[model samples]
Target: MGQFIQKTSFSEKDFLAFQDKLHQCLEALELVLERPGFGLGEPSIGAELELYLLDGEGRPVLENQAVQDTYDDPTLTLELNRYNLELNFTPLPGTGAPFTALQQQILDNLAGLNQKMDPWQGQVLPIGILPTLQERDFGPQVMTDLPRYRVLAEAVQQRRQSTGIRIEGQDSMNLVHDDVTLEGACTSFQIHYRPRGQDMVNLWNATQLVTPLMVGVSANSPLLLGHRLWHETRVPLFCQSIDGLNSQSEHPVPPPRVSFGQGWLRHSLIELFRETVQLYPPLIPILSDEDPLAVVAQGGVPKLEELRLHDGTIWSWNRPIYDPCNDPHLRIEMRVLPAGPSAADMAANAALFIGLAQGLSEDVEPLLSALPFSYARTNFYRAAQHGMGASIYWPNAHQNSLEERSLAAVLEQLLPVAEKGLIQVGVNKEEAQTWLSLISDRLQSGQTGASWQLQQYNRLVGNGHGNHEACLQLLKAYCHHSNANVPVAQWPDL
Candidate 1:
């Protein structure tokens, strides 16, 4: 969805010329919101990460096109599996030491993809779900040959008539596939956040009421194919892997193109790109010659590329982008963290989401009218199945209702409201207390990254080591404690 389409078989006249260039890119986003100095004047931050390409015994290594033809960099790319790979960094400016320059640009592009996967032994891991993944490693001949990922696995397996695709927590799956290439087994790190003028819908509803306290202290995937499911099995294996296409007769209950929405967005931000072009349908209608209303009637700034390829197939954990390059901002991606156990635990989960998105975008518009988008979508799947032992439901006040609490009493009342929203956005209160003290020492040592990968996979299966050699010795001690950048609460325990 990062633009690049010539063909993948779209035709109904290419979905009526991409719904007439997605209604002229929603009338050039209401003429760039009646132009009053568009975005990027200060708050800026970015990331993408998404790794996993292992081999030397820790499985899955599709050579990401020979490490993108031997890593010629331009922020690398390709992902939708071929053993995945995605980097994309540049944005930066949300105040000093920007997470130590995005953790030294992700350890200098993970040491240049570990020196080009060392003569093809191929390693580069950064995980979310790769505990030796398998189920015949997600079929469709290991996807990523790309024609827009085979027209998005043939439009989400032709809108689910292919059926079977189950997932339940503590180990349970179900199959039947033709191709949504099991959503390339899941991988994420995705942060973004631009937020300038009109504090972008109160920092997108304070990032949807703090995505379950940033997926409950950033739970990494707690093992999948080797069972031991959800601490964050990539959040219901990425919302039941590309589900959607079960029209089973009646209509109107729509909204599950992988979501935690259907409420709260009390108006403009073009009502989430007009409810994603009025509720999905064009999983890749390809055609985009870009005329976002003749480039905003020639004043310039268009690239809405069919409303950013139909809002990049809507897997919204907290999406709503719109980046027409050169100072044309409007961000808020934050797709519920989860990438690795390191780069300082993904820059302390991006400094607890840029200090709770600048301390709840300045008092989240009257605490979003006393919160209740169904308790922030049921506190995001109960913090993706109990990571930090879930219990959520916040917004207190002499208990007028929603109480529940405990992710250490909601990180002791939001880590001093994300360190006074990272020292009111210019950060540097000792670089926002060194990445919010690694989320307050991973919430005072509760140790998350899925509780240190379920306590080092049950202490390497209680010292005997079985389940695929204890998930390749917990992926070789989680790549030597994520290449020694450390942070999963000081690692060591296993």
Candidate 2:
């Protein structure tokens, strides 16, 4: 999605050409994957943090372009909304102290961006959904003035006619929009893991299995449009926001553009790319110059631009990535986690997620057999809706049956698994212990980002602040603690 194109429109011919290219890319990917030395390197991890730019009143501010103009950092880029910006960190090796390095990178980059925002009296926040955002904040006008974003908006609106969002939690919200800008309200801290080609299947399956547990512990973005929605409102908000499938159509509808997935991946990672190309129609079908088949024949890596762009359009919680930059490789992009609370908190979330995925992959077959994929899907939504308070079904080896267990209790049992996974992946013992302890502490305290936000909001509201005012005050306190880089578990109550 970061690859930029100037073209704003695509014709029928363009779509046909792009579709052909996608198939060719898949063929080339199959051959590439079979090569002896392909993607054979030490494991590495990277992340992209999406954030909100806010004004003195704790509302969204449109200054991403201005920040880009004054700030000379290439890692920082504009998001779908002008009020949002994303920071891409350099990939670090899994060994030594990658999580600690990630934490520092976040602090350094965010500090530099905040310094530039000082001139505009603007502040940067790394939350899933900014609670103060109003209905007027979204629409055609709020979209970033980029060709990709504009074309994406037009493409989704064309397919769905209109996007309707109906979320029922502590408060209910039912609204509709003609454009996909509502997706801009949700931000995330996406983690990228480049594993050896042999471990791809196990790692990918493990990621899916542990996602619910990760979401439960790392829950954030509880409030949206001041409605106090799901503990992690970004999950449903993002899915319903840019959904392209129209139920009114008489033809059979495809899976949603944003989804957990239809079912568990059976054979290889190639199955994912094939399913993506076959099931989902091309949204932005801009043809690339490279012939992937020709590149593969010449024993060279193909950029697979069309397949990548198409894959980017499909918002899977765990998406497969094929990158030809530097050395050609495949990576699993974990898109389930939200941004913020603090840099340490974000790093801790990543550590637990990556560690658990690695640890569980060793025995993933039995785990998957014990817990059905449908139950895994159910657990994901339940975790998002209830956060730490949610009870999930887990494989109880002792009874040889699936047992309903508290999310916190499940996390407690999984902490050691995560730690061992981290060590297996080459993360130093001290680094693994330091980061995993944060998760343990958070679970013990029952104070995830969502819980803290809810508690603070309720307290302020009880003290006579109006809903909107409480949101602003909560955001103010949030920014203060987040800027201090304090863990969410340790943040003081308002």
> Please, what is the whole-model Cα lDDT of each candidate in the order they appear?
0.78, 0.88
Instruction: Give the worst 10-residue stretch by lDDT in candidate 1.
Output: 244-253
Candidate whose TM-score is highest: 2
Stretches of model 2 off by over 4 angstroms after superposition: 2-4, 196-198, 244-252, 397-400
Clashing pairs in 2: none
For residues 195-277, what per-residue lDDT tens digits would candidate 1 score against the true structure?
Answer: 54556777788778888888888888888878887788787666556763353223434556777777778757788888888
Candidate 2 per-residue lDDT over residues 230-316, each given as its tens digit:
999998888777673253233436767888876777888999999899999998888878988999899999888888889988999
Which stretch of 10 consecutive residues in model 2 shows the poorest summed lDDT? 244-253
